[model samples]
Target: MGVRALMNDLTGSKSDKSECWMSLRAPELFRVMEKIDKEYALVRKDAQKYIEKIDFNKRMLEVVLAEATVAYQEVYKAGPLYARIPGGLPLGGPCMMKLPDTVLFFHRMKLRNDTFLRVNVLHNDMVNMVLRAHLSVYGLHLKGAYDHTTTGQVRGTLVHTPTAGELGIFLEDIKYTIEGRYRFMGDRLVIELIVSTLSIRNMALKYPNATDSDPPVRLLKKNMADFRTGLKTDLDKWVQDYFNGYLIVADLQDIPSLWKLREYDQYKTSKLAAFTDLAVARINKRILDIGGDYIRVPKFKIVAAYGLVINIYDGALRGLDTMYRRSVATTVFKRDNLRYVDAIIGFKDLEVSYRYVVNFPPGPLMPPSLTGVLRMSAKDLTAHLSLGLLMDPEVVELDINFINPPGPDDITIEGAANILMSNFKHILRYEIATIMSNSLMYGVGLLRTLPRCEPFVPGMLRNTTKLGKFNKKKTLSTSSKNSDEARSKESNYTRPQRRHGTTVKMMQDIGTK
Candidate 1:
């Protein structure tokens, strides 16, 4: 009948034999066996899921690894999150975390490298002037040219109300617009991307801004609905709804003259940035979630990033059209998959009249004055780099201008290509570890498969390896052509009798001359 009764019956009727073992032991062996089975069941349930899809999408593991690198860059930039040791500016300053002048150490020091160092935050006095000029150009009259401390807007606001139509704010100075190939939608901003703009807009500008609120975006004080709306997914909808505009007048005049501007700077940026980042991230995630092939994915990311930028310029077009042409943010990269992105949050080259001041020490003498603002060729003129490729652990190794710096004499297309190819070969040989693709793409290694091929294996890498996965820049035509030729079993596609500019040619160049 029951298990225990059955056991006793079977034992029989051997109850005396079973009783002797039980008498010797403190714990029953069956009880231990039952506990072990229960433990294993739980472990099996937990482990089965991970093991089943161990090599599937793989993002769960990659996300962890990738995010750490970003976190490290952030921490490393913020301070020596890695290891901070103190020294002066030249000696170890670049490597050191803190400056001689005291302040809470940042998780990362925003080392803004610009085409021109003077315009970056390396000096404070320059940035202030850039802001003041931006204010004057917009006629926000927010701050006076001579006085750096005045945070109030009094110019035309003194004479009249900033009618709802005045909500005009924009960036006209950024590179994509400045280079003059971009367009502006009359009702709302829509940045048209261009090829030349990839490195400038997507690399330089975005990285500086991305490093957690340094210049602290100053979009507003009280409400951030504007920033949110500006960041909405459907740019077309905003165009339809806000065909008429709204001018946001900060009651800056409400504050006293003695009050400082920096008091509000950090807070103001915090509010606006939260709105922008949330909206951008939301839109990007949605676009990626509805995925297509690799080709379609990057376009969605670029489109989302550009939408924010174009809207900023379009919003401020009311006044910006004066000193600046309507601004635009362009997507670049000959290949669709490789373009750069950043919330073209705004693009006006900021130009300001500035005086650097340092506070003097108190005693027999006070700490002398030191102050300045970031100066640029223009106000709000910035290039931002935000894109999916950036998230890949593959390090970026090229910049547009550097690859082909302008010569005193103009260089032809062929010459430029030669320069680029040389640099590319050099970088490939050394700088790159992961030449990127949709997944964790890597280079060919020296190994091959077992004969049975239970799972296909890697073949050996030659001393001069040519086999590798395509990068974002590689084209479908190139790949298809290669595949077609491979099907034909063609091995002599590349002839090496003599050449002038190829990698093999380079050896020839070096050998002859």
Candidate 2:
């Protein structure tokens, strides 16, 4: 109040015309101007902080853009245009999501190549026997040898044309629709080709147990065969009706008698269903014996895809006693060019042990003794590839270098243990390396010799391509009951369980009918 009164007095004291106008201003106007200045100061402080934050965000965005540019350039420099895609290797494990049948692109898969068909021994004979039994199950008996060769050589040709990415395979005497599904595990691609539907093309002429000697039997056979020949539709439904109504349900009691003459219980099992099942089991057993159940894809193929392939499956390199101990291995390309690509394998965490015997001729208080556990741990081990024009891949050079070289501390034994340990490690290192190389080569050799036409059938009849061989002598000789029983015993056959209960239902329907 004192200051305001003093300021009023001063304005009143001024009598000049210009000074008199200043005295006319109210006190409320000065208060309002002061309030506006205080508000502006608070807002200016907050606005400065916001500007700094904006600058920081701009710098971060620029850095991200620069990194993206470099990544794009490197990918451009990589192999093909497809390789630049997200699923490309070194990082793209299997890259399977891009396509249905294959990872990137799988053009075609043909089973029996006519130009270079490599049919295995006995494939034909097994096929013919199985077909004969299958037809017999449906009461369709073809007279004179049910020779498959007359129609086609059981030549299973799988043709995948450009029109669709479908796989068509001819499994000797039977026809089935196949579908493929795939998955990625670590660095490998596993494709499961499964049967979607079952079908039959060639029909039978005569009903089971029908004899050619009888007039009605001969007439029945002729009429059925002729009727089947004229029909241009799928025979599955017709065969099902024929089997359920006339063949199996009516002759259920006579099954034993009918098969008795055929010697069908080759497996010696009480659960023998039909001669067809027995033949199927025999073929399954044979495949198991030959190690066709599990097929390890040649690692080189994966190597080419990824450029660097890592396999935790130590089995391939386990042939070497020492190499078997420390198991992780990686196959990588050392160099790549238009002429050729150089690949090498690198091993990690390698540890090998050896045993030695030292002889000290009765010196003072000593005798011959054996030393235990002379251990050597390799710091690094590498192998170079030497591939020629062969179906298999091979490693030519193996260099084993230790991170911690062998020291006296490695041996606990007393007398000339150092000398023995040194010699042992030296020989063991190279021996293991050589064995590991050969082991890898052996696996590749199998991949080369074994048919690449399809994945090996994991189980007999379960996942079979049904492609097989034919032989008139074998088929005819094995038809007798005594021969079938003897063969079944030899085969140790097991009846396969149908995945879909379609057959069981069909049988039930037939019984009801």
Candidate 3:
């Protein structure tokens, strides 16, 4: 044979192996590999008897995603600061960033453009499609089309400037329907949804019975008695259909992040996230030993009488908070070399210089949130108008607060507020991108706008000068002195004001709100 032919023959099948004698594993070893696969087959019932490991299946999880809308709602509270609703927001642009004027203005211009698609865009689309599908399955017809088509999108503000008393009472322009979205990669359904928000308003659609001249939404709201007893049958059936189809369409390997987060939270934050990563890494090393690219992977399936489904829709975007927290911890660890050997283990000996430190709550201090909120429009085309507000919210803040202090892992309201603002960096950047993407969404020309805000400088300086008198005294003490004459600064227009209050830092807002 030629040199090339000889080389091929040498590296070929178990033939001319006089120079090489590689031993093969026995049949028993194959059984072991097969057994290794079987571990993933059985449920973890009676795990303590056979597995003898601390939550063995728990080691199989790495990351989790939560219901973004619900997560957002949990942190949402009425911001007290006077916010300037930019002209663009009222004119169909998304200015969901709710904050005081100075901060709100800056972020509205920033989050105008972004790459991370808002979860709501996916949600609205999904809800529209699935609801239509449900109606089709039920053979229901709409009396009229959405308002955006029949009547132009109301050019004026849908809501008025609300007072402090109207804090919890929002004039809901939309109504009840489970608005959420899910992505299917083959058979897995990676879904995100808001099961419930803390809000208690009925924002569901009312079907119209009148003629075209007076096109009010047709409301098929379930009888309040029926609703209180249980969801109406049609609604319940539709719910099952939506979730079942949502999950079944995706193959078993495409489970979503929202479900994972719920499951993880149920387990009380089991250390599963860490163990699964290490185990998967170990399995990969085994494949590397055999000079193969293929590695052992997870085979968790949601089997039922209908069929066996396995899904693996694992995305970190679902766990925005947990991921952010981890990111922060990682940065700190990397900066500090991740060693605690030399540091004090407890705060027993810790002494503070400040006297009488008091803690306040988190929500009222939060900057407006400006991330993840997408377009919500009541534009129904097929003779069924959207029965709710089509709000394009621009969030300016999300405050993270403690529910209960489990030892020293608690955060103050001020700390949580800072964290929320820090994470909202993406929101700011995306707003700017939105402007660049759409031509009609242009901002005030920089040349013309720059000179306009300059005059407010003198006013900002005056506020600073006034802060000195209030500094050495309590808020009530100074306010009472000028009770009648003083023009109390607007709470919403907190911009250009120096920080005040000693107890302001301790607000711990747990958003069961």
Encode model 1's per-residue lDDT on 1-513: one tens digit a residue: 687764443333233231111111112222332343354444333333432344311222223223234554454355421112111111100010111121010111221111110111111011111100010011111110110011113210111111111111222222211111112232222223222220011111111214545332332211121111111122222222221121021111222221223232233334334433433333222212222001100000001111110000000001111121222222223132232322343223222111212222344643233333211122333222232221111111111100111111221122222333342332212111011110010000000011010101122121112212211212223443234234223322222121111211111111111
| Local accuracy of candidate 3 as per-residue lDDT tens digits, 5-50 | 7444324343312111111111222233234324422322222223
- Residue-level lDDT of model 2, residues 1-513, one tens digit each, is 487774454334333121101111222222332343354444333433443445422332223223324453453455211101111111101000111122111121122221111111111011001111122111122212110101012121111122222222222233332221211122222221111233334432232344766333222221121122111112322322222232122111222232331222122111212211322233233334344433221111111111221111212211111121121111111222101111222333333333334333345654345344333333244332211111111111111211112222322333355545453342223222222222232222222212122222222122233323211211223333224344334434322222222222221221111
lDDT of 1 at 377: 24
- The segments of candidate 3 whose C-alpha lies over 4 angstroms from its true place after superposition are 1-176, 195-408, 412-513
List ranges where model 2 is wrong by over 4 Å.
1-339, 387-513
Q: Give the range of the ten consecutive residues with the poorest summed lDDT in model 3.
A: 381-390
Question: Between 2 and 3, whose lDDT is larger?
Answer: 2
| TM-score of each predicted structure versus truth | 0.16, 0.16, 0.16
What lDDT does the true structure give each of the candidates? 0.20, 0.24, 0.20
* CA error at residue 481 for candidate 3, angstroms: 40
